[model samples]
Target: MFMFKNLKSDLPASIVVFFVALPLCLGIALASGAPLFSGLIAGIIGGIIVGGLSGSRVGVSGPAAGLAAIVLTAIGSLGGYENFLVAVVLGGIIQLVFGFLKAGIIGYYFPSSVIKGMLTGIGIIIILKQIPHFFGYDAEPEGADSFIEASGENTFSAIFNIFDNIAVGPTVVGLISLGILLLWSNVLVKKGKFFEVIQGPLVAVAVGIIFYVVTQTNDALAISPAHLVSVPVPDSFDSFLGQFSFPNFSAITNPAIWVTAFTIALVASLETLLCVEATDKLDPEKSVTPTNRELLAQGTGNIISGLIGGLPITQVIVRSSANIQSNAKTKMSAILHGFLLLISVILIPTLLNKIPLSVLAAILLIVGYKLAKPALFAKMYKLGWKQSIPFFVTVAGIVFTDLLVGIGLGLAVGIVVILLKSYQNSHFLHIEDNSNGKHKIKMSLAEEVTFFNKGAILKELDSLPRDTYLEFDVTKTRYLDYDIIEILEDFAFKAKERNIDIKLISKRGIVENPDSFIEFFKLRPKSKISLS
Candidate 1:
């Protein structure tokens, strides 16, 4: 079976992913204004149910950071947590419809640069957001709002608050776990197979739990359950199964539920597609996933998660990248991690409660660091202005704003830079030496040349020497911008008297522009080009 063969290769990764998921499950719950157990449920469902069905080998699904804002808002707007749960169920059904309709193709429409910006932006947000957690600030949960903390203050104020109310016990645990993680990661893994077999996160979590057990029994250094994860324990099998939440079929008539449902469906799908793309790149084998199949799997997963009273789920990049870094070679690693979540809640509820939140925070702090490493910035800088500008803009925007908005700003900047370069260069503008006693000057417009490049191109054409055998070649250009065509048409009048030959070619046909070129080459109202 796939599970048996990949067990060894995936064990270390599953442990690392487990540590990563544990905090996230808790943090997303706190942020969403939902019961903490709901997030854990979602994580279990994502891993066991969704992960098992995924077309992607390495992508790890769970309650997503991107959806926290929506979840928080929806719960308030719907007037109750239960109402929001209804929306979650509806959302999953909508996603299933979207998958069957082949809407997953929309993922391909997003530009690679924009997607890269999104990942880098999220990376910076993770690092900046985790700073308070690293310093032992537990008042505001990890993955709190970029604009405000639980105290309703901005990022800087939150940082100050963390420093002011630093918890010594949690801080100590954080530091110890961080130390073990760092040492195991940088030193131990490279030294021998034995150390590599047991990942740093596994070692860190094991140590944290052991520390908890020892200290709790001694009374002098006991950590309370509040500082650890507190999943409710079921007294019996029936009670345990009863813990699962079911969809309210009565909610079917509520228009508000449908609206919230569609929103979650759209956002969750986008995030999953993005995470899947990023995960594939992170994989050591560099395999590509079928986007449509991923959509279907994610949709099915969300339906199951919602039916079980869990939060909305998506393919999360942090966990997925952690999976890849852990050397996961098959989807079995992801599925097994899900099983671990399921089993842990049932069998090790007490032990889970002893592991400190600060320790998990320290683990995430490191995960955040790996994602937004200083070397990543340096490498982007070395790639020159073209790459560096977008990369840093993405980082800065994310640090200052939320994830989607930050990526949108970075994408806008990237598009402007691309247009500026295109305007400054010539696509078809060229000078040739004709041996037959004629100076052949050729000018070409780029495929899908827009008005952005019009001014520079027109200027270049106006400055061309007179009495030259000018050949206007639009053969290779598709969808010439009307402004450019108008300029060319104006040139044609004067060129006619000056003996310039204008030859226009397109998918439509070759034709000379008459009086005003705007009428001749204007874009059809419905005509569109694929920019992605």
Candidate 2:
């Protein structure tokens, strides 16, 4: 009786996400300095556990690109891989606490412009990071720490090194696999019914294995099994079961591990929160993900992943976007992808080894392009200066700094821009209230009205009609520049001269003689506070 009614609709999405996730999982592990198998384990847990419990319909979870830096640092700091595992387990506990405390609300504080900037910035990073891997560079880390480090010494330099001493076998296999993958996605799936039934990533992975096997027979192909995913195959069921590492409970008492735990929890939660927000925008159905529920799901997944020798996982936006673009219909597609991962590792271990890192790089490159295309820049620019300036600043900041820092920089700029715009338009100092017989004079402060607003204040006061009751409102103001506050205090003295009754209402309060807004807030010297 059980059946997937939307199987057809979900098929394409599953295939696309499957392809997108495969290399990301392996690359993240390689960058993290962990055994490649651990990445797959995280992928499985991310898809099955997190996917099942998520409020999101399309987002696919896995080890994140952003976490690669943290993972590398953590593995080194903890002294050993085993020690790092202990930190991960503890991290899960911290994430659970975050969910309980409703920390997901942190996503709301970010401005929309900043969020778009983050996406564009990350897209550029992905493309930059993958260039070396696509060119067959293996000596350096896949995701380097800084942009300058990428080449001449790191992954990019390693890519240059590969040109003269290119491993012919791996290079050939990688190129062939990449060709097949591209063809499958852009051609075969579109033209052939039989091929359409099969996922492009699954086929490409399959072809990669077959090529490896053919090359292995003659020893003519330079490619070796070591270059591929080196998943430890167990000879028996017990050995296979024994391969998973458990968390060291004794390490919980160590202060260093606890610190590591807290770091992981915070970073993972922030990434997950961002992913949830970004993914909702990509979903065609426009399903909004419940932030708190998503946190709980991510927390549970990380707890399990950490206990099982896996890297920390997050709801990744790229994978989620792939799922959306792929036409994923429900959560079932996500769960199926997890099962596919589980089966691939177990039954077809030999096949997975053939997947050339280059092929996966190509897939990610395409995804990166979609996220940070030139058209996106043009489109954002057309949205007006309010959107374009923030977006551009965010992109530039991220390129120069890191993700969070870049977003912060963009947000700061956006706030300042908004304040300036408001200030330029804040010439009005009063309005009329037809019903109250009281002249409701609404005064708006400039984006940054320091003592300079006193000139405007003097002008408005001089023009006040005789016997008028005035309501001086500054609620829409951003920064009540200190000068303006001083002017307000001075204006209190002239209200009687103007024959006007002045009522001040703002984020601060009615100032009889407000010295400084910041000083008022700090002093908490209450006068009269009213809200509309």
- How many clashes show up per model? 1, 7
- The CA-based lDDT of model 2 is what? 0.71
Root mean square deviation (Cα) for candidate 2: 6.4
lDDT per residue, candidate 1, 72-162, as tens digits? 8888888777778888877888888888898878776555555666666666666656666655565566452244344465566767788
TM-scores of the models, in the order given: 0.86, 0.78
Clash number for candidate 2? 7
Q: What residue runs in model 1 are displaced by over 4 Å at the alpha carbon?
A: 144-148, 151-155, 216-224, 425-442, 447-456, 462-469, 474-487, 496-532
Q: Cα RMSD (Å) between model 1 and the true structure?
A: 4.3
